[model samples]
Target: MSERKVLTKYYPPDFDPSAIGRTPKHLRKQGPKVITVRLMAPFPMKCTNCGEYIYRGRKFNARKQTLEEKYLNIPIYRFFIRCTRCSGEITFRTDPKNMDYECEKGAKRNFEPWRDSKSGKYNETEEETLDRLEREENAEHEQQERDKMAELEEKMHDSKREMAIADALDEIRTRNARIARNEGKDDEAALDSIHEQVDESLLQAEREDEEAARKAFMTANGERIKRIVEEEEEDPVPTAAPVSAQSKPAASISMPPPSSTSFSRVKKTKKSGNLLGIKKKPSLV
Candidate 1:
């Protein structure tokens, strides 16, 4: 059978980690003093090399060293430590300007620098004052431009309205003049058409009258010739027996004068009109 070995350690309640025994001055100046602090609360951290988070209240052996550089004329102290996981070098220091400790470069801190700057005694910075003045100047210039535009608009409104009215009136007058000219042209054209129609009608009437006169003359002559022919055919006329020169007058008187109509009765009427209003059919030929 194998036996388990046991080990034990003892300490007193008055233990102090900061207590140091007297040491030689030459040895103290040569190296930085290291300390272990208990974190009151959790702090979130990330390792640069391993990219691991180190939770707050974790123990670390850190060397404390003072830098010659200062912030706000106050000496700054630095803590040098190695990451617990990757042993990556990290450095941090107290920041008096922001009233919070800031990570110099190795890692990031979540503290906001402006938090302490907004105290009751805070004053406006030079940049902030200049930005305010520039804003005011720009606003003033814009207001002046708006005012100028408003004044110009007020003046232009009346002039534009008057010009628009005048233009409308001119357009109306021009339209009226053009319409009058067109009407006059139409009237002149109608009058010329009417005159042409009247002349045509007169010429037609003259031609018709001439044709009627010729027909009437032909009919009268034909009737007279026909009657003469019938009478000669019906009764043979005895040649007047050699009437002596002395009996000539008596023979002419004895024979009744041949019948005839007067020249006036046979004349064709000159009047032309549609007295009966009869519709005559035109010859297709």
Candidate 2:
């Protein structure tokens, strides 16, 4: 907790705002709330010069006045207890709040004597004006520092925003690159598929050409065999013709004697399908 600063003003014993109309005149003065009371007690007082004991309440007059010291908050009523023996005066105060008497001058209070002395000594010169000016300068310096801190904070915020924007731009670039890479990948896949389709079409064309060549060769071989068979059947062997052979020589003509093509054809027929046996010739035809 922060300690409150004591104001530089002297307050007497009986200033109380709460007791405005109810307090007595002695207790309603403009001062502190505590007061000290003094009594003329017939006590023995020792003289410091002669070392003689002097009885109090003698013809030596004692002055009872409140001593407004620098440190004491409550007005200390110093009884100048004088001794008629050697004109020696001993001063003491009665503490009214504690209801105790103390001979010691040094008492503890919230008021600081050093601070009071400093203020008093400075008030006597031009140093008070300098102190006020210094206080103003310190306040202005603190305000400047606060402004500098605020400016630095604003710069930091701007920097953070710039960094965020830069990061967003970087992310956008990355996304675009990724999208372009995906497009490239798609294009590559499509090209690969197109190349595969072309290769398949070429392979199919080769297969079709192969089949066509095989079929054409087979057709040519069949036509050549048919022509050879027709030529061999038209030219019969020289022999006496039978009556049925003279009427239909070409129909009754027999095939030529077995060569390589004929034997292969006969073997292919036997290998390929079921065949029926021919009837035996009756005569030379």
Candidate 3:
């Protein structure tokens, strides 16, 4: 037991080191370098050999090997895993272009809804994609044309509205101008009529004044003549002296007798009032 625990080992003095054989070159260069690594499944898959389902994140001792194929100078790697139930070999490789993995054999990758939706290339052909793009372009063009037509119609309506508003404004301005002209004419005519009425009233007042003065003067002269006639009749006349033959007969001065018809009295009527400082006399009866 002590000897087994000892660190040093005994060797024969006649041991020969050159008798060991070396590995053959043909076997060394036969295949790619394969390394055993512990890894988790990247995606879920179903084993084709046994129809057994394998979920993601399952741990496996996989053989990883670098292949000659490269994408943009980056090395590609292949992984070999075995199904747990049937021990069937499953192979998958890294896809650098798509940044995913592709199953080569012995298994079928499960459908990933998120990945299919993101790629937009699931189960669709090239012709179907072209048709879909063409339909979208046509729909966008039609929409653009409809928008342009709507804009044109809106512009036309705006122009028409502006024109109508301008016409209405013009009509209103003309009407206002005509009304102003008519008002000015009416004002002038009214002033002229008022002046004429004033002048006519003045003329009528002058005629009334002249007639009143004439009637007053005639009444005064008739009264004076009647008084003189009364005085002559009341006094006796003296006898005249005899005229000599030497003096021609002096012409006898004669006066006309006063008559009632020589002057006529005027009748007066009631009047409203006097104008222009003229006073009216009271009526006798």
The order by descending lDDT is: 3, 1, 2
What TM-score number comes out for model 2? 0.24
Candidate 2 Cα lDDT to native: 0.62
The CA root-mean-square deviation of candidate 1, after full C-alpha superposition on the true structure, stands at: 31.8
Model 2 Cα RMSD, 1 decimal: 32.1
Q: Write the per-residue lDDT of candidate 2 for residues 1-285, one digit (tens) a residue.
A: 233565565657987667666877776567533333444544444555566654444443456666666233666666665444555556666665434455542212233355365556423435665787799999999999999999999999999999999999999999999778767777778679779999999999999999887676666445422333444446767898556755776866787787777546443334322345565566975
- What would the per-residue lDDT of candidate 1 be over residues 47-123, giving only the tens digit for each residue? 66788676666667776777778965898877877777778887777766546566665555444355445652235
**What ranking emerges by TM-score with the best candidate at the front?**
3, 1, 2
lDDT score for candidate 3 against the true structure? 0.86
Our model 3 lands, by Cα RMSD against the true structure, at: 32.6
Tell me the tens digit of each residue's lDDT in model 3 across 30-66: 7898999999899999999999999999999999999
| TM-scores of all predicted structures | 0.27, 0.24, 0.36
Which model, 2 or 3, shows the larger TM-score?
A: 3
| Off by more than 4 A, model 2 | 1-34, 37-127, 130-150, 153-177, 180-285
| Per-candidate local distance difference test | 0.69, 0.62, 0.86
**Which parts of model 3 have CA positions greater than 4 angstroms off?**
1-9, 18-31, 113-285
